[model samples]
Target: MKNYTVVAKDSFTVLGIGTELRSDYTDYAGITKEKADFWESIKQDGRLETLKAVATNNYIFAVNEAVNNKMMHYAGVMTEASVPEASRLIQFPKGEYLVVKGEAQTAEELSNKLTGIAFGQVLSEVKDVAYVGGPNATVEMGQQNGILFGEMWIPVVRK
Candidate 1:
């Protein structure tokens, strides 16, 4: 079973790169690979380390939103500092969120697992405790230690 927690969070901002993604399940693999490639490029160019240095928190968030049936996926760090060139900034409003935590062997695995739990499990389970309709944001948080950990943050409102 997946372990999760419900918590309240304050408003925060993140700055990083992103790409448009389709919500169709068939496109999942391609989008996951694309995001992985982006992270790899950032690491090779030393941009990942730079963002980490000024990051307010250790969590690297993969934020997503649905627009016109397509998804906008953003891989970024939460920080108030000025981001490097080409990075877009997104602000997350304060709200209650359902947080699911887990560890994976690779970024691909983490992405798949988190997505499954967020949409498949959390969405179904949350109906009894909270209402998740409206404009809710989903975030996949990266690991902090040596382990490849991931956390899914789903914004919700108590029923």
Candidate 2:
């Protein structure tokens, strides 16, 4: 079973890149490829290091918006530095969030668990905690450990 916590967070911004994905949950290979490509490109061009240098925290975000079969996914860092020309910037306004910790042997496993289970559970049960919908921001925080450590952040407000 997975456990969650509600935390108040200040507003933050992320600088990186993104791509839109459209696929049924049963066929997410396309979206996975797109995310991998974005990360690979950034690493190849040394942009990842640039963003990491100015990052306020070690957490990297894999933000997503899934409505119906369409999803827009962003792989980015929480940073105050100017994004590279090849990258995009996303701003997450201040809000309370439902946070959950996750661990996996690989990044792919981590992503699957967050999207397929963790976030789903939070969204469905948030009302029990007086959660009110706010921004649609769903952020996946990446850990620096050898094992893939992640935290999923879902924005919500108290009713």
Clashes of each: 0, 0
TM-score (all chains, Cα) for each model: 0.76, 0.73
C-alpha local distance difference test of each model: 0.68, 0.65
Q: TM-score for model 1?
A: 0.76
Worst 10 residues of 1 by lDDT: 131-140
Residues 1-159, candidate 2: write the lDDT tens digits. 447888888887777566666555456687667777876876798776777777788766777755345566766677766755525666666877777777887766776676656545766865645444332333445556577777777777675
Among residues 3 or more apart in sequence or in different chains, the pairs in candidate 2 whose N, CA or C atoms overlap within 3 Å are none
What's model 2's lDDT at 2? Answer: 40
Q: What is the lDDT of candidate 1?
A: 0.68
What does candidate 1's lDDT look like per residue over 48-86, in tens digits? Answer: 777778788777767776645756766677777865543
